[model samples]
Target: MPDSDLLLIGLGNPGAKYDFNRHNVGFLIIDELARRWGFSLSAGKWQSQSCRERKWGSRVLMVKPQTFMNRSGQAVAEFAKFYKIPLQHIIVIHDDLDMHPGRLKLVQGGGAGGHNGIRSITQSLGGNDFFRLKIGIGRPGRGEVHPEIPVESYVLSNMGAEEQEILESRFDPIEEGLRTFIESGVAKAMSLINSIK
Candidate 1:
């Protein structure tokens, strides 16, 4: 494939049990992208559900790995190898607990920040060089509900209605940020997305 071809992977666990969890924000974003771009990831392959579409004159492969969150790198590596997509041309979307709810960050070549899915991908790819679109799910604060809960439990929990509303309201901006990333590249995307409150 040409350098213009891109691979977009959304990290999430499979099965209905995880469909609405905070960690499944990547899956939600993938669904929104498909809806906006007119593609269906109904086909299963490479341990994922995938679809290809032409976007900004380049072929974009959207994939949701079914290998679960921890082993996501296996699916990502397989797809990247098969498509010959370079690390810079790959983008992974997943949830972030460090940022406040509804905030988004577009970053490149960074540490996993304790995210198991990202850690797996970094290890499998031999580096942390891929672009990431991180959707903030927020962490427990002092005196907040479940402040004593485990991080794993918090991430696996479903989003409250208010939190879901906040996320839904930012979908348009997130979509625009993704478009900017695909058209103008990661630096531009990071500048634009990180500027958003």
Candidate 2:
């Protein structure tokens, strides 16, 4: 059993090849958090890699689902069920194509907005009440090599140098905002993250 009821899940397709893809921003955030916290992830029975630590008076379980992007909920559901964690206590971090790169939005209880991972989690958890930290990756445009790349291909592709730098620069703020979330709640976190220019 888990010592804490709070859970944080980062969404991405598992494997080295997809490491820097636009769809893997959540995983990148998880990796950065792990680096900053000095924690390490280990394979878990729920088909996820995770680390646990007490932060801000909460025993937080940070997880990276290994069940791939679409099936992420399978691992998340297993862990949540085993830990007996409530929906409101769970937070998911994922990429969003609707907003420009480097943008972040923290919110609770909403639709998936066409994200398969969020949709899967909502379906498996039987509700959309969980919190979400959205990292914007933006939609592809005609300036790229392909005149019209499909959304799937665009997201699965690795991020360009400029985009990568922009996103990386926001990591510090993201960390601060997440700390706010852990220390307070989604509302405060949203105020901090969403205000980032």
Candidate 3:
């Protein structure tokens, strides 16, 4: 088997019922990348659905963890161990409540920001040195219509059509950022992606 130079892990819950939820943006981004790159995620291993593809002169492994959100690190750590991928080469994509919808930011070696999936990955890896592509899913503010909704309930809820539209509009920039990260390095990708509105 060919070794992957970079491992892209998308953190999300597995199951049809949770497919469209806000927390599943990671899965959605992976799906888009797979579709755009002509790779099919039909293989299952290491508690993840995975596919390999050579893009921009690098072998990339794309994985969607089946271990659900909180336990996602198990799958990620397993794949990283088997592939001998360093922490710096592992990139995780997940939803963020820090920014409004349609916004994204790329960072390396940061705290989990209260994201359970990220917390799990950080613990499993014994550190928080990997890269993360945070897709924002803005939280309900005080006195908002859903102000009473808890963060857990809000994240699991499906996105409204308008929110989905906004997200769809940001995919192009996200893809470019990913490509830059894979081909160059995280710093370069961060500079480009973080500058995006």
Candidate 4:
């Protein structure tokens, strides 16, 4: 049996300014759960902001890296090592442009695609053996990319009110997914949520 309690790490650029962006949905989910369960993420440790909570008799540690998006792995790796968490016990929650809004995907051990945060984590951990909970952000509108702009700016930028409305509705299922991940396992959570439209 895995001795390490599952560690759920939310990926995003930290700070008030970056809070509401499409890329920050992972952080938003953690924030929503914290609010619902009354946990404080004000603590600074493991190069990230984190909170510890008791849920369904399991100890849950929710992490948000303060190291910005591109270099998120440093904090994550440290947290995993310091807490003695095995790769099998860590779950990363992040935004995915590929999945449509209100869609959720859960996977174990995969490449980071073009996500700098996941890339960094993989680099730091020296492998892609960790669990991932990908929340959809959808791709940008037609012809939005241009020369000379950094992806960092694009990801950290906030979504509009209409976009936010769509995402705002997704919080419930995502919250349930977290609970299910703890109560059941990744396989059960995947079967339950992915089976939804």
Candidate 5:
């Protein structure tokens, strides 16, 4: 009901059909955080399950939109305006096929690279001033397990067991990066996270 000091979004398609896909890593992280923090993840004013957490005096409102991935902009834009969370205070976590598995990148304002969810957010927010915590899923071709399945098919397909293993291993590290981002600032977070090899 009240504005949040921070809003973190994890982009992913809705429905059990996409629950295990690489692209749904964002959703997975959101769910995992809810489980770890003992948050109810109950429905809120914006029709999103908002998990509340306070770190460094910041009331972080984490949302995993029930809307399918591409329509993410609608939920994010509306919720942000309601809470008055500035673009700078918004961070999106999504899977990136360009980077190796378990890799993460922090970027601000750029092309969507065919990610409809990001594209929708950019369009809805009127610009790309927000930050993105990109989790790399690795390119499909060139000896990788996944192939370029066009944006739609690729994001919907389930992750292989091996891929899931990799993701399971990186969960804590991702959470740590988020913790640093919340306790410190993005610059400091990046400095601490970018070099994680």
Candidate 6:
């Protein structure tokens, strides 16, 4: 399996303080996936915590960058170079502010959409060909929606109980979608993940 045939990068700031924040949804998803797949975590190369599992005849490496959100690309680029992972085989899971909360969308080769983490990654990688699995946290102060909170504060805020429950509920489908991505390809993964309503 060449050590690691696929790389899954979850974008988030490290530390317990950011654990349940909306911006940390990527970390939450990665943690849940690691638990479900029985992948043990360890301090990994490139400023990240990671785990590797061999399944379906491939080595899947999952990482959560500990370099904080803005500098995530440094860790990602370093890891990818060390593993010799191709750009197309890398998947970055992160939160999105453009879509409604609880929505999931998978896309490849897109602009960062104002995400500093994504921007850093794109710059470090020197390309935008990697896959992105975006879990929507939505923007605040739109109409009557959370108007008191600023966008920065909103994302860093802990999710409301209802929001947390909603995201947890989608974990099953997210798992299935990731499995499909590994088994099939981006096309199938997109069909499965983007269709979630």
Candidate of highest lDDT: 6
lDDT preference between candidates 1 and 6, better one: 6
Instruction: Identify the leading candidate in terms of TM-score.
Output: 6
Q: Give the alpha-carbon lDDT of every model.
A: 0.86, 0.87, 0.87, 0.79, 0.81, 0.88
Shift of residue 153 alpha carbon in model 1, Å:
1.2
Mind giving the per-residue lDDT tens digits that candidate 3 earns over 43-91?
A: 5887789997798778888999998899999989998888888898888
- Please identify model 4 stretches exceeding 4 Å from their true place: 1-4, 141-153
lDDT of 2 by residue, 1-197 (tens): 12446788999999999999999999998998899888899996788899888876778889999999999998888888988899988989999988777788888888889999999999999998998989988777723333388889989999999989998899999889877777776778889999976
Clashing pairs in 5: 140-146
148 in model 1: Cα distance from truth in Å? 4.0
List the candidate 6 regions with Cα displacement exceeding 4 Å: 1-4
**Clash count list over all predictions:** 0, 0, 0, 0, 1, 0
Tell me the TM-score of model 4. Answer: 0.88
What TM-score would candidate 3 get against the native?
Answer: 0.93
CA lDDT, candidate 2, residue 161: 96
Candidate 4 lDDT over residue span 58-168, tens digit each = 778889998888999999898888878888778888988777665778889888889999999999998888889887766655244323445556567787787677776
Scanning candidate 1 in windows of ten residues, the lowest lDDT window is 140-149
Q: Estimate each model's TM-score.
A: 0.93, 0.92, 0.93, 0.88, 0.90, 0.95
lDDT of 6 by residue, 112-148 (tens): 9989999999999999999999998878876445878
lDDT for predicted candidate 3 compared with the true structure: 0.87
**Least accurate 10 contiguous residues by lDDT in model 2:** 138-147
* Lowest-sum lDDT 10-residue window in model 5: 142-151
